[model samples]
Target: MTVVKFLRLPENVDLPLPSYATPGAAGMDLRACLPDGDVILDPGCIALVPTGFAVEIPSGTEMQIRPRSGLAVRHGLMIPNSPGTVDEDYRGSVKVALLNAGKEPFTIGHGDRIAQAVIAPILKPQIVEVDTLSETERGSGGFGSTGVKE
Candidate 1:
C-alpha cells in the first residue's frame, strides 16, 4: 500500500494539537471548549461550535468533516451535514454543526473531542453549461423508488 501526506498548519489564533494518527493516516485533535467540554443538543436541535482553529488547505484538496462513528451510533449524535465540504479557498474558522437525533440531550464539554476531519484530494472542473443532459437508467426516479424490500 502507498501513503499520501500533506503538511497542514493552524492559521492565526488557531492552535494545532498533537495528532495521534497511526501510520498512513491523518488526524487532528479537536477541543469542544464548552461547559465541561460538552454541548447539549436536544432532539431535533442543532449547535455550531468553533473548532478552535482555522486552516490553510492546499488547492486541489478538501477536508471531510464527519462525526465520530461511536458518537453517531451510540448517541444518535452527528454532523447535520455529514461530510461537510471545506473548500481550500475558505479562510474562516472551521465550525461543526452538530445535531441530536436521540430522545435526550448530548453534552460536549471543553476539550472534549467532537468530530474527526480527514483531508483528501479534490478535482477541479471547468464549467460547460448545456441546454440538455444525458439520462440515467432510473431517470428522475424519486426517493425509495430503488426498492424497499430485498
Candidate 2:
C-alpha cells in the first residue's frame, strides 16, 4: 500500500482524522473543520468547506473528492464538481465545494462528515492531432441517444 503524509493544521489539531468507514470502503470520510459555529447553506447555495489539512500524495496519483451518499439522498447536498480532482502536486489545505440542492437550508456542523476522498492512480495520455479520425457505432450520439436502459 502507498503511504500518504498528512499535515494537520493547528486549528484542526483536535479534529478527528479522515478514516475509512469500513474495511471494504474505497474512500475515506472527510469532516468539516469549521473553527466557528455551524454553517448554514441556504437552498441553491454553494460553499467551500475546509478540511483543515494538507496531504502529500505520491506522484502519478490524485485525490478525488466525492459527496457523501447520505447527504445527497437525505439532504440533497452534493459536491458541485463531483469527484473533484486534487492533483498530486497540491500541498494546500483540502476544501470541499458543497452545493445545497434541496428546497430547505442545510446545516453543516463542525466535524460532520462533509465529503469523502478516494486516492487513486492517474494516467496522462499523449494527444495526437490528426486530420481524420475513426468513427464508432455511437459516434456523435448526444444525450438520450443510448435510451433509458442498456
Candidate 3:
C-alpha cells in the first residue's frame, strides 16, 4: 500500500482519508458532510468547498479526485470534472467543484465533507518523433468508429 500523509492546515480541517476509496471498496462511514439550508447548483456556479489545507507530495506523484457515490445516487450530485487531477508541483489549497443534476436544490454546510482526494504515482511518457508510423486494424478511426448498436 502507498503511504500518503495528509496535512490539515486549519484546526477544523480533519478530512478523513477513508471517506474516499477505490471502486467496489466498502468503508465505515456512509457519509460525512451534513446538508445545510437549500441551495441550488445552477450553471456557472461552481460548488467548490475548501479542504482548508495544502498537500505536500513528493516529486513524480499526483492526486486523483473523485465524487461521493451516495450523494450522486440520492441527490444527483457529482463533481463537474470527474477524476480531477492535482499535480505534484501544485502548492494551492484543494477544493471540489460539485454540480447538482437534480431538479431541486441541494444544501451543504460548513465542516461538510464535500469531496475526497486520493494520492497516486504518475508516469510520464517519452516523446518520440518519426517520419513513418505503424498502422492498426481500425486505423484512423475517430468518434463513433465502433458499432453504434454494440
Of the candidates shown, which would achieve the greatest TM-score relative to the real structure? Answer: 2
Residue pairs with backbone overlap in model 2: none
**Residue-level lDDT tens digits of model 1 in 1-150:** 323233333322333452545676465545553532456688889999776666667677787888877788998888888888778878776778888987888877666677877778887689898998899999989889889888
Best by lDDT: 2
In candidate 3, what are the lDDT values of residues 1-150, reduced to their tens digit?
555454655533444543434565432121232233333566335576656555666778887777777777887778789877778877776666788886667777655556656667788999899998799998989798987896
Compute each candidate's TM-score over C-alphas.
0.73, 0.96, 0.71
Q: Total backbone clashes of model 3?
A: 0
lDDT of 2 by residue, 1-150 (tens): 798778898779678778999999999999999988799999999999999899889999999999999999999999999999999999999999999999899999989999999999998999889998799999999899989977
The alpha-carbon root-mean-square deviation between model 2 and the true structure, to one decimal in Å, is 1.1
Full-model lDDT for every candidate: 0.70, 0.92, 0.63
Candidate 3: list runs displaced more than 4 Å.
Answer: 11-40
Ranking by lDDT: 2, 1, 3
